[model samples]
Target: MPPRPRTSRRTRRSARAYAILLPAVAATVALAGCASTVSLEHAEDAAAVECADVVVRLPDVVAEQAERQTDAQGTGAWGDPAAVLLRCGVPTPGPTEDRCVTVDGVDWVIDESDAPRYRFTTYGRTPAVEVVVDNEIVSGTTAITDLANAVSVIPADGACTTVTDPADVTP
Candidate 1:
């Protein structure tokens, strides 16, 4: 009887490569099925009715990033890599030099110190909402606009002012 032919060296190497790659591919596929996980710090002041409303009203998609699963309440995140993250009930900020922009009706104080990653906080609302957006992944305005609808639920008590009013200045 003729002896069975031995597998070629190239064939053996190919098989080994495939064996090593198969698990990696499977792991990637499995992770793709699961939503991106976002770790968040829970806010102590987030128990307000307005915060709950904002959370419920948060958009499912922002700047084309689908909302992902977050581990904390009063928090919302978007994008597979979490390009945008929002947290409600943060302590209100006092006077600052940060640039402020109003969208829809909500006032946002923009902090670009980190560049590419921008942090926007509600100006005068109690338990102010804070949104951190990756400008590299999504435009800051777009993220703020998408979240504004939800954040507007919290009424603004005041707004950022660059100049102090003469009437308010004490002699």
Candidate 2:
């Protein structure tokens, strides 16, 4: 019988390394395909450490929608189509004519200019948190309520209030 050539140690090691790595790479790619990342723009103060605190505390599931991975810092998205999107470290909202509601001790200024999709921002918290919810997909109330605890990580410096004008009163 003819003698066969022996495989070199380096070639055998390379084959072994590939054999071990191929499956891992395939599995990782498969898993990555399963979970789609939601692209989002970072807030102005997204780099702030306080934003990290809020992001870490975000709920896994919000308004019956599961949380998805976001590309930006201090941002969170829930729902496959992303019915709810949250951005922390946004500019603090100034007093406006917009309606404000307090949920779970957190005051949120509601902007209804865009119907079916409302923008709710923390009323008094500096580096305010902004939550945009699509009413058709999920309840804005539920989304805001679910996010209250996490958003409350930033202490409230002020609160939503109604200014009474004396001129409106009839003598």
Candidate 3:
């Protein structure tokens, strides 16, 4: 019986061909049109910015506000000054159609200038809670917009205005 010679190169070439061909076939199969569904995870959370106690600092320094007692008037209207007063723990002053309600000497009003609508002034300090998905009530200046993302009411535009004014629109 004669012994057959072992062809080393032939074996090597076939193995290499198989390695290349296998991946091509797999890739085509993966690309073939097919219906499939995938589920994705999402994350959500409320705004965590602090809204109280901290001192408010504004640039383009206004000498008037620095006087401790800033008389914010003509802010157009308080979304519902009455409601804002209630949120600030102000007692009922009297009957009124304006968005503002009276409490003692100073009238309480709602300021919705910044995003995530919020109260500009409180009993003594300004409320600093970041109103997420609401108006951007940054610092004290409120921007005019109709984004509908306002968390409170429409803010009075231009110049200084008090939310206590009945003309102001309250949420």
Candidate 4:
């Protein structure tokens, strides 16, 4: 065979540079394809302390939704599509006519006005814990039940009552 053509210095340098950059570019693309990061607004200092327990005790999975990374101080998200989202240290809601359910000793006010999605907020807690789940994707009961343990960290000061008259019920 005839003598092989020698590669010029510039050509060799270009090949070396490309070889070094290929892996980095591939890694960046791979990371970008993963579940997007979620960031929530920070809560007040007082609520932040009250939320620490629940945040730390949150389960890795809820209603079959795997936990994902969150940048918020007191928030968590589960599933690639985010079937469940939790925010702690939220403002405590006052008495309302909304339906309430108690799970594992933790009272939750259920809001289903938005069909296919349900919002459950802890009742009577100083700094309430809020959990939003897509009913279409996961069972609302299961998701709330899974979070009961973490929410229990906040003590219950009161609960929902069915008394229609003050005189009919004894304090």
User: Which number leads on TM-score?
Assistant: 2
> Per-residue lDDT tens digits of candidate 1, residues 54-144?
9999999999899998889899999979999999989899988778888888889999999989999999998899999999999989999
Worst 10 residues of 2 by lDDT: 162-171
- After superposition, the stretches of candidate 1 with alpha carbons farther than 4 Å from their true spots are 1-33, 164-171
What TM-score would each prediction reach against the true structure? 0.75, 0.81, 0.17, 0.74
Candidate 4 structure lDDT:
0.86
When sorted by lDDT, best at the front, the candidate numbers are 2, 1, 4, 3
Cα lDDT tens digits for candidate 2, 1-171: 999999999999999999999999999889878988999999999988889999989999999999999999999999989999999989999988889889999999999889899999999998899999999999999999999999989989999898779898888
lDDT of each model, Cα atoms only?
0.91, 0.93, 0.28, 0.86
Candidate 4 lDDT by residue in tens digits, 1-171: 999999999999999999999999999889867878876676553356778888889999998888888888889888878889998887887888889889989999988999799999899997888899999899999999998998898889989766376678778
lDDT of 3 by residue, 1-171 (tens): 899877799898999999999999998778542412222111111111211111122111221111111122111112211111112112222332324422332233344455354543322212211211123222223211111122122222212233465567577
